[model samples]
Target: MIPVAEALERILSALIPAPAETVSLPEGWGRVLARPVLARVTQPPADVSAMDGYALRAADAAAGARLRVIGSAPAGHPFAGAVGLGEAVRIFTGGAVPPGADSILLQEDATAGDGLVTPTEAAQKGRHIRRAGLDFAAGDAVLEAGRRLSARDIGLAAAANHPWLHVHRRPRIGVLATGDEIALPGDPIPPGGIVSSNAHALAALVRASGGEPVVLPIATDDRDAIAAAAEAAARCDLLLTTGGASVGEHDLVQSALAPQGFSLDFWKIAMRPGKPLIWGDLRGTPMLGLPGNPVSALVCAVIFLIPALRRLSGLPAGPVETRTALLGRDMPANDRRQDYVRAELARAADGTLTATPLAVQDSSMLAALARAGALVVRPPHAPAAPAGCSIEIVDLSSLGV
Candidate 1:
């Protein structure tokens, strides 16, 4: 068995970032930038008006000052002539600030009629003027490589004159479920049969982690069936097989993968409810064998698989986000295995975060997991903790619901 951190290090060290592809800015959000995006043109391009007002020399824009309206400058139509003394240009919002105009008199403070305008309020130099390249300059590094593009980032990139961006390709993850007793959702169940939900859950997880999920057909426990499914999954960049990872008599995933020259990196983790986790390289693709229990499979995916997907998408391998919370009840000493206890979260009147571990932590209980908002992390062999003890927790909100 290996520690969770060690396992993560091993997995990350063996993988490489995915290849790059050019995608339209609309489709670039949530994808990692493979190269820095430089500004192709300056924002605002030239000095412009920030509001609909009269652009004139600041000295002539005093209260009760009168000036002749030489021309109008609405957005996209620049006044060919400059503003001279005692002259003003009617500039609308986003309109270019005509030459010789150093300030603006807002329309609310200025009355205009008969090809002339009068200032009812004082104006100062540079007011209401958007200087050229105020937001960004040409050739500026608008965004750096390894950034996960957000909606705001996309907007900024578009403002930087980028119609498209070079970003990492979303990895293709293949998910396989192996168990004869498991049936697809809505399928008629035989005695003792259960719905095959791991694949679906894993597919959603993959998509949430910025990867495309291809759910393979469920494979029975038979060696041939599992082997055929394994081959198909191996064609993807990453393969995730749920069930048949343990050493049980019926656990045949490892055995089936052996004939395909799968190079096992590690097969167990020093973590409760997920000790049977498996990691290895199958053909040229990375593979992970998750335990059969639903909660265990999903938890391991959150801990390990998501980060792998993030790295493959050219994103920084950031640590799992954790926050400190006070324990709402007593917790017993843990054994050799590190524990991730699902817990409900609440905030106290004093803004203190409190986490209460669910009474039952059975790996198959998806209901309890659903109700949980955080995972209370307990290291292996941790001492018993009384109520009010501070504990580290991973907020599930960060991990897509």
Candidate 2:
């Protein structure tokens, strides 16, 4: 048996990022940046007004003094005339601040008349004027390579004059569930039969990890049938299979993979609910074989499969978002394996996050998984944690749940 970390490293190294693709800004969210995006044009290309106010010379403005108004300016329109000493121009939000004007007196503080204005207070320098290149300068590296596009990122790119974006191509992942006793939903359950749910669960996992999942049909526990499915899955950039990985006599996933030029990277690990894990490569496509237990498969997918997908897409997965939370009840540590305890996060009156583990923790309870906000990460060496004890919480919802 190999250690989990070593197997993870091997699987990650075997996968590489796909080629870059040009996509529209609307469709680029969560996609990694393929090129260093520079500011093609400076935001607020010139000095502009941030609010509706009077643009005037800051040094000359005095409280309660009425001054002549030069012209009017609104958003997307610039004043044709400049402001002279003791003169102010009527300006609205997003309008260009006229040349030689250093500050603006908010409309509430000033009174307006025909070509005349009055200030309620002395206008201060650098007030309400957004200076040219304040947000970004021309040629400035506004976004670095590998930055994942978000909604705000799209806005920034637009501000920087990017009409389109170049982002890393999403890796195509194949999801398969193997076993003879498994049946799809809506199918009549035979004696000792269970539903084949691993594929759908894995598809959601693939989406959460920023990859596209191509779900394959259930591959029954037969050497030839499993081999044919494995060969087809190898066409994608990565393959993920659940079940048929243990030492059981009928487990044929290992044997089927051997004929397809795939080598075993690992077999078992010191882990609870997931001792039959397998890792390898198939025809240049990396594959991760997870236990059929619902919770175990999901946890392994997040821990191992997700990071592998990140590497395959050239994304920096080291910065996964995690927060602190207090345990709602006492918990025990594992004997020799790590454990991920799913829990719902509730904010306390004092602004603390509390992780309350659900009572129904059976791996088959999908509803409980859906209600969880995050997983409380505990290593094998963790001591018993009492109620209100703080622990590291991995944000599952942030992972695109």
Name the top TM-score candidate: 1
- Write model 2 residue lDDT over 2-57, tens digit each, in one string: 55566667777677787899988788788999898899988878999989988999
Q: For every candidate structure, what is the RMSD over all alpha carbons to the true structure, in angstroms?
A: 1.4, 2.5
lDDT of 2: 0.82
Candidate 1 achieves a global lDDT of: 0.92
Candidate 1 residue-wise lDDT at 57? 98
| lDDT scores of the candidates, listed in order | 0.92, 0.82
Model 1, range 1-401, lDDT digits (tens) per residue? 99999999998888788899999989998999999999999998999999999999999988998899999999999999999999999999999999999999999998888998989999999999999999999999989999999999999999998998999999999999999899999988858989988899899999998999999999999999998988887658888999999999999999998998888999899997799999999889899899999999988988889889988999888557789999989999999998999999998899999999999999999989899999999999999999998999988877895
TM-scores for all candidates: the values are 0.97, 0.90
* Model 2: residues with Cα > 4 Å off, grouped in runs: 64-66, 319-324, 328-333, 342-347, 356-376, 381-395
Candidate 2 structure, TM-score to reference: 0.90
